[model samples]
Target chain A: AQSVAQPEDQVNVAEGNPLTVKCTYSVSGNPYLFWYVQYPNRGLQFLLKYITGDNLVKGSYGFEAEFNKSQTSFHLKKPSALVSDSALYFCAVSVREGGGNKLTFGTGTQLKVEL
Target chain B: DAGVTQSPTHLIKTRGQQVTLRCSPKSGHDTVSWYQQALGQGPQFIFQYYEEEERQRGNFPDRFSGHQFPNYSSELNVNALLLGDSALYLCASSLAGVVLGEQYFGPGTRLTVT
Candidate 1:
């Protein structure tokens, strides 16, 4: 079974400061990881994904994630946070092969960027 | 591209009633998946439909069923609704066989059971 874990229930960061939302996963095979953000009353927006390439994957809205296979982690990062960036973050994992497009998602982490 | 769209932004139903949610896949997409998200929790997969057939299903009971039209639009029907069925139902669409393609989500239909 593929599973994702987001250890933090919420992350607080000041605007213009760097922000990091932690995520880890457990899968029997290679992992396909993704990060999505959802604002209140809106649908989830895709941030980025890590299939197999550079460890650091850049995504929409100036966000990026590092895929650390050894640590079984794919933590989302932003060089500078913005108050508008505050939203609920979700980490999802799927098997690299034969998983049939099904994704196992984390419980989600609320990120609050303050001015 | 019009993105994914769902109908009935909000709904209220009583126990033992039935409800149906609708979704239209994004333009140029052929696959649609349904998910149920409880308040403060991650979305749980209900099923996926492609080419007017159910390709895969989650651990949901028989009460949950779906249908896909030739145009790639879809509908999710829940029978004998329970109070636990109250949640935001999400619909996502993606290009089939894209290999882990990113799914575009709709705003979701908020269903409240009374």
Candidate 2:
């Protein structure tokens, strides 16, 4: 089975400082990885995804994720944090199959950007 | 583009009651996927619909069923709801062949089973 793990339950970061949310995945094949953000009462919005090429994939809201194949980690990173960046982040993994592509996600990490 | 749209923003139901949620995929999208998101947890895949047929399903039980319309709209029907079934049901859609792994999500319906 394909699964994703976000080790941190919550991450606290000061405004204008660097922020990082770690994620690791387990899958049979070279899986497609995705990062999604959810606000208090909203649907998940896509951040970015790593399908095949270049290890570094940039996404919306000035966010980027580093896909490390050797470590099986795809950590979300941002150089500077904003107060509005506080939200719950989820890491999901999917493998393309003949029928459909199903996404299995991690428990999620609450990111708190303190002012 | 309206992105994806789901009906009944919030719903309340009792045990053993059945609830139906609707979703309209984004323009040009042909596949619809359903997910269950409990509080403080990531979304779990319930099933996927393609070509008006159920193409994939996750670990959910048979009590959860769905239907896809010719216009690419979808409906999720859950019978015999339990308190554990209280969750935010999400709907995602992606272009079948054009976009391999990209999925767009809808606002989701909040279902509370008492």
Which candidate has the highest DockQ of all? 2
lDDT of 1 by residue, B63-95 (tens): 999999999999999999999999999999988
lDDT of 2 by residue, B52-74 (tens): 99999999999999999999999
Q: State which candidate has the highest lDDT.
A: 2
At residue B23, candidate 1 shows an lDDT of 99
lDDT for predicted candidate 2 compared with the true structure: 0.95
TM-score for candidate 1, please give it: 0.97
Q: After superposition, how far is residue A8 of candidate 1 from its true place, in Å?
A: 0.4
Instruction: Count clashing residue pairs per candidate.
Output: 0, 0
How do the residues A7-94 of candidate 1 rate in per-residue lDDT, one tens digit apiece? Answer: 9999999999999999999999889999999999988889999988899999999999999999999999999999999999999987
Docking class of 2: high
Candidate 2, residue B72: how far the Cα is off, in Å:
0.2
